[model samples]
Target: MAGSNKDIKVAVIGAGALGLVTLKNLLEEGFDATGFERKSYVGGLWKYTLDETTSVLPSTVANISKQRGCYTDFPYPDDTPSLCASSYIDDYLQSYADHFQLRPRIRLNTAIRAIKRDDANNKWHIEVAPTASASDADTETITFDKLILATGTNDKPSVPKIEGMDTFKGQVLHSQTFKKPEDFKDKSVLVVGIGSTAGDSAVALMGHARKIYLAHRHGAYILPRLHNGRSIDHGLTYNLMTVQKLMQRFAPNVATNMFTKFAQKIQDTAFPSIHEHPEWRLSPAPSLRQTFPTVSDELIPGLESGDIVSVPGLKRVTGPNSVQLDAPKEGDEPMKLDDIDVILFCTGYVNDLGMSLLEPRVHPARNTNPAWLALPGSRGKPLARLYRNVFSLDYPDSLAFMGAAAFATPAFQLYDIASMAVAQVWGVEAHNTSTLPPKAEMERHVDEQHAWILEYARTGPVYPQLTKQFEWLAWADEAAGTNVGANLGWGAQGWTFYLRNRRLYKLLTSGVYTPHLYRIFPSEKRKAWPGAREAIERMNQQLEDELKTKKV
Candidate 1:
């Protein structure tokens, strides 16, 4: 029951928005933490729910950019509107958990139910309950030395088992239970995924659908949450981790044809009809990089008013009013689609519900679990092995995993710099436990980040165990000193200025001048942070003078 007051506590789990900024950066690193959150309040998935395990849609906004999707000690209200809504990022994450009182250390409505570890007091246990369990069932458990797992990956909704989709007849939703498109008003839907909830839920159910339909197996790169008006991640995803290490020092087909022709010239000026289908892109394997998409502030308009249409994959389930599709042009024949009253499925979730709180005590049948992070497949799913995906090479310092990956960082600045590098690797065993590291150097950094995420993620996506948010928060502040890599002042002379002019020092330090001029100050004996780098350089120079005075 873990309360002998041995002192070293911490339990975390999921209060969302990276577990309330990893319980306020592990209570500002003193760390006698708590947390929980099975919702009763807290903006996990930015709140706003009709709750089908939250995936957000109903035209969900804030697809990053309330100035890099805020929260490094709050900054969203300059009369709020630098791309707002998803209820203003769930009221700026419930006013950043009640402005840091962190609502009396979290635990609302609870619900864990099994974490187990104890291993002769190495500590962990967990088990919890209460989503209102009174029938007879009960739980409680407790214990803890460490165990963060800040429920990152939008849990639930990985749908996709087509073939008869459980004999689909009519209404079949699941864009994480889509909050409300007036429940497809005049009906005739059919959405399906390519994401950003299949193009903003087919433009928020095209004014109450009488015809909608978007389907899709490929051709994405939707983008545009304001391009020329700024914040279409203001170029190179406004700092793709030092532009993928200065384009992996060039010459990989010259950094993949110079960042895929600058992401096909920003999708030929904001999606010229999805760049006129370079054969519906996503690759028949020729290095798929239309430069990340499925973004959308709103842009669907074509079909000359017949009311939205795109259809292509899903060649099955034909009756209960039709659905065949996939053929058009490969000898042209598979159409069907007929009257379909509703089909939705913006299909996304499945970031492994924290793989039933992992059990792996030295290969107990090796299921290094994150619900199988996939790859040795017959169709991959469920996997986890983290070396730098936040510890856990078979439970090092008792499990840690905040926000698992940073798909384009700033979701709590890479989960508060990997939860303050797991409290600076548990304050390195109270003074230099041989400055940590070994365990085959964390299994060779999780087998070189799982062979660099199976290089190009083999053709599936979510692989972001943080692709460079200031080089993984300066390699977790140089393997856990947590000064956030000494405030990225990284001067060994900037690796000899990135080995001399690596693309003009990565286009003059990935904009916002020097990749967001530093902030993780939990102490390196108090360096900069007072004025926080000149108020983020006068708010990135008044957001590049308000995106260069937007007019067009």
Candidate 2:
């Protein structure tokens, strides 16, 4: 059946982590696929350099462990640390490419210029140009039967223009340009925004910078990287996905209270000095269920020790060397900071969805369909009309966006599963074995999901792409005709698995839910990797061994 896709030519844009996995899945399903990357390397932003490319800081470490970070089929070596460094992640991605023989199919230094839909012939016309460092290849146009946009969400950095910023004598930069700790050595730096980057930058500057001021608009639940000497993800978060879903569904308020209470308890236990020093004003969000968390081992400690100061939202720039902050409450007086050398805005990035590359009408905002327009709060949002956050309602058969949505789970595994779903839908559509829902039905489903998202947003922060891992797995599995949930003891088929295989069932439910388990079962759409079971067992053993030694 894989041979049936030889005639289908697929073009994948952006060769980052998601793009690499997208290309791998397209090729695995036997599509004649080619990947385009603007950079010379395959790791995208993970391939760090001082150049304009957005990358991690020199001291950056993965927020999650390698077990969740790596691809399913390929597990990290036993020697790898539980928390991988940026360099390790970069090397691991390169290893993934080499192991799968994907480099030959990739065109490094080739950048996509424009993509036009040929409605008459049902093909995509893509224009590409080689970068300056690459060979002097002339710009060329290529045709493909399908297009996948893996360009990623972090393309356009969100930098706000503060009033009197021009008068500021010191340097003002976005976190995208932050390189190393030495850049701000012995200087007073004001790090804006309270996300992971803000926490990281503040903590990384701890002994280097003379003073660090962390400013934020709202409160955040700062979680520790380690709890009781074990990685928090492996010891606490990974095993609670099912419980999280159950509480969210049946008792929403109760779940919110319990989670927030537990998070506060952890914060209090980890950083006891914060409670004693009320003037520091590290007010946490009432419900962490709404906003993303800031994870760091030293951020709170730095703040508690008076090395870093926490302040309210930035109000305005007062002078070249000073800035005013908002009152913490309605009655309190506003605060001001002076002698600041650098103001690093850790404000995040907006997703770039083929804005300039594709025709204007192809964008979600320009959709004229009544059904799409009828969806509440769907207008003007680029990714709102997507069904399952992959297929386009207008051109479901020809277009899909990989790594479009943001999830707390591992990025690589999510993109791989989503890519497989795309491959399966396109692979079978040609021969009449299609499992794709009809166009109108897809529009209705998209509208319903949009409504649900709008309702969920009313409770907390506006995280449009924040999705649950199991829920995404359920949708992706149904689209690909896979029984991953059933095989892994989730949903209705979980009962059958529980009755049939008790040993595996116990491991699947109680043990770590590693990425490899997704590929452990057979599927008609995609072949099961024989090594998946071995990978799962190896990961379990590694975790057990680490726990025995307390190296976690």
CA RMSD per model (angstroms): 20.7, 3.7
lDDT per residue for candidate 2 within 1-552, as digits (tens), equals 334776899999989998999999889878899999988999877877887668887788888888777786788777788888888989888998999999999999887777899999999999888863444357788999899989876676767668888788998888878877777889999999888989988888888999899987677777887777766667543337678767877887887788778778877777777677655555646346435678887887787688989888778899988999889777999989888899988877655555447888786535434433344332223444677778878788888887666666778878887888888888844432436788888888777766666655555444545554457667887666556666654566777877788877777567776777677777655668899877777777778887789752
Put down candidate 1 lDDT per residue, 1-552, tens digits, no spaces: 332222568888888788888788667656688999877887777767776677465357776777666755567767777777687788888888887888898888887766778677788888778764533257777887888788777775666666665666789877777778876789898887666667777887777778887776655545567777677665543346545656755544666677556655765686565434443433332233312456675644433344667767676876776888787457878777779988888766656646555565632215543433554221244446676676677667767776556554456666665665676566533432213478998788666655665555555554444343445655766654534333333666456655764754443455543223335243442233454544555566777777677652
The prediction achieving the highest TM-score against the true structure is: 2
User: Where is model 2 more than 4 Å wrong at Cα?
Assistant: 1-3, 132-137, 236-240, 278-280, 366-383, 429-434, 456-460, 489-496
lDDT of 2: 0.76
Query: Which candidate leads the pack in lDDT?
Result: 2
> lDDT of each structure?
0.63, 0.76
TM-score of each: 0.33, 0.90
How far out, in Å, is residue 141 in model 1?
Answer: 2.2
Pairs clashing within candidate 2:
none
Candidate 2 lDDT at 280 equals: 57
